[model samples]
Target chain A: MSGQLTLYTYWRSSAAYRVRIGLALKGLEYASEPVHLVQDGGQQHAAAFAALNPQELVPVLRHGDQVLRQSLAILEYIDETWPKPALLPADAGGRARVRALAQAIACDVHPLNNLRVLQYLERELDVAAPAREAWVRHWIGSGLDAVEKLLAGDPGTGAFCHGDAPGLADCVLVPQLYNARRFGLDLAGWPVIARIDAACAALPAFAAAVPEAQPDGPRS
Target chain B: MSGQLTLYTYWRSSAAYRVRIGLALKGLEYASEPVHLVQDGGQQHAAAFAALNPQELVPVLRHGDQVLRQSLAILEYIDETWPKPALLPADAGGRARVRALAQAIACDVHPLNNLRVLQYLERELDVAAPAREAWVRHWIGSGLDAVEKLLAGDPGTGAFCHGDAPGLADCVLVPQLYNARRFGLDLAGWPVIARIDAACAALPAFAAAVPEAQPDGPRS
Candidate 1:
């Protein structure tokens, strides 16, 4: 059941970055095959990738012969297969709480602001640059604000989203906040999110998953 | 923990609809406290609703003091707490696969095509009405097509998304297809999705959760 572990990823893709954090946290290293999201209408849509993932998305994890897609699902698979340093709490309520927080970002925030959606707005809707930026800023600002409230208000928030240790919520949150920061959204309103992001940033798992840390991280 | 299960929901919100289906499937009745998404800039964002959910979106299940947001979280909570008519499988890989199929819709498809995102596209991007619909059709069609392929190609598909029983993935898929049909998106390509939707429709749990079946269901 063991073979070469390969991850199809793009450096700046938040979804890919989330999986990278999970893999690193599990301390399992895999071959990095970066799929450029922006070049050539996204190599993710190429025939080879479609053969791998009909959804034509990055962050497809190849574990031996079983290829998995979707960051949250892949995270669950990793947790199941590895079981160490449990990314989720043992209790059902605790797991529910963690998944809820993760979905607040994954299902609500990041999806609305993804690259393909933005490209659709530009090409199909003819959204001008400024308006597009405004659209990005508006959702990012609101979403981060909501996440901050979720973190600050919920007693579940400890040093991280659940307790003193990093979990699934952090895996999703850190990458999303990084994207928000990339768009230059005013994050001053989000003290709790900033604090949680800082907690995650201190860890090797999260630190290693940053966009700039990837093999094809943007050339500065 | 059982006093007055109030669901903060919208008439047409598929996420909310999923939770409604779960509640029905478990034979648990709840109060439908409508949070209108389009009227008054969304009642979900009101100061009162925000207190319960910082995300301020529909499908907030309030069971006494424990307020749960996110449909999947609520579904899992119900499943784990009640432990009857379980919404997940008995085994781990089966659970993972079911959850993966559910996430394929809840996180990937529904999130990208939700009301707020569509409104943003039109209001911010100046996307003409006709082109906006093309965008919707593109996402819903392709996303459902991917899901259909997953069901058709996998050995997993039986009477539902998992086996002879309806569970998390079916809970998610039914609502998404409801929304897709509401938008008049073409479903000609996804016979698998259509077949599953038909199977779900024959059941009382899903039927009762349809928009028309609710107290706040949109009047035809």
Candidate 2:
């Protein structure tokens, strides 16, 4: 937990935002080195960054010689190293529920609308800009709807994704909602997500980690 | 681990295949209550199944009162409860590496091409059958390409996703490859995955869990 944490991140990437919230929750300090996904023909594609992560993706957390790519993976490492504010639950069932919610977003929702996927839709599928936007909204909407069902239906869901205090699922959801709103996707259908996200944003960890508050946030 | 573990699964559902592999690895006995995903307008949509999983997805693992949804969640739960021949690595970094590889499949790849999304493409987007199949192949190809890059590029990858042992990453990769092969997507490009799948299938645990070998498999 004390090994000079360095996060290779993007200000606006939802996945990166998930890791930031996790670090703050665990009271871990890390230097944020931004990797602009779009700037200068994508810095992540550069040889320097590729050396750190062959996937050439951001939210690569480097602790000493160990480099962890994938935001969820980095978050898990942080949780294991610092177990004070546990990201997962105690019981196996509870942990499964929390992880299920996290994957509900991480797996089902975010990938369809990621910058790379969107770019692919345009370049490969020849989808029009407007249709591409619709595609984004479609996947996001269905994904969030499922999440809403998971959160709302389960009595286990408290103020956050699990038991009041923000945990792993909330770490994932808030950033996704940020992207959801940014894309102009209507969230009126997902009340549970709205309430949970509100609770998460109220927390300093989640608030400070918001993409709009980051160093690269739209320049005022 | 001793109780009746019922996996509500479809033979061809890769997500279910993941849990099947996990259960097999843990040497746990379970009932394969087939969910018939494509029959009678997707048996997963039946009122009875919907009550169990509101998400209307296959591969819900039922153990006593607890009904576990999501393949990764069930796999992790099985690992935690059993804790023998651990699916994840011993070290924090190693575990993160394995989980990341798994999520790279569970999160990034399979979700985009799952049953629901394909149904959506056909119904909502008016995509033709061939185009939908092409869509499946496209995502699978791109996703496997990314995964191949991750596994091959990482020096940590030994015989399995981590060291010489097959762990969580193999649990995810093997099933996804089943789906990929079922769809007739080319596997020649993904040597890392191809090699890993071969290793997994060689094991009794992974072998017993193959879709063709399942209770609900064709001719089963």
Q: Would you list the clashing residue pairs of candidate 1? A: none
Give stretches of model 1 more than 4 Å off.
A1-4, B1-4
Off by over 4 Å in 2: B126-134
Instruction: Report how closely model 2 matches the true complex, as a DockQ value.
Output: 0.66
A171-202, model 1: which lDDT tens digit per residue?
Answer: 99999889888888756678888888887888
What TM-score does candidate 2 get on C-alpha atoms?
0.94
User: Taking the candidates in order, what DockQ does each have?
Assistant: 0.66, 0.66
Per-residue lDDT over B1-220 for candidate 2, one digit per residue giving the tens place of the 0 to 100 score: 4568888988878888888888888888887899898889889889989888877887899898888988888888888989997998889988888888888778777887887877776776677888878777877787787788878887889888888988889989888888888789768888888888788878998888888887778984
lDDT of 2 by residue, A1-220 (tens): 4578888889999999999999999888888899999989899889989777766677899898788878878887888889988998888999999988887788878888888778876776676898878888887787787788778888898988899777899989988888888879767778888888788877899888988788866777
Q: What level of docking quality does candidate 2 show?
A: medium
**Chain B, candidate 1: TM-score:** 0.96
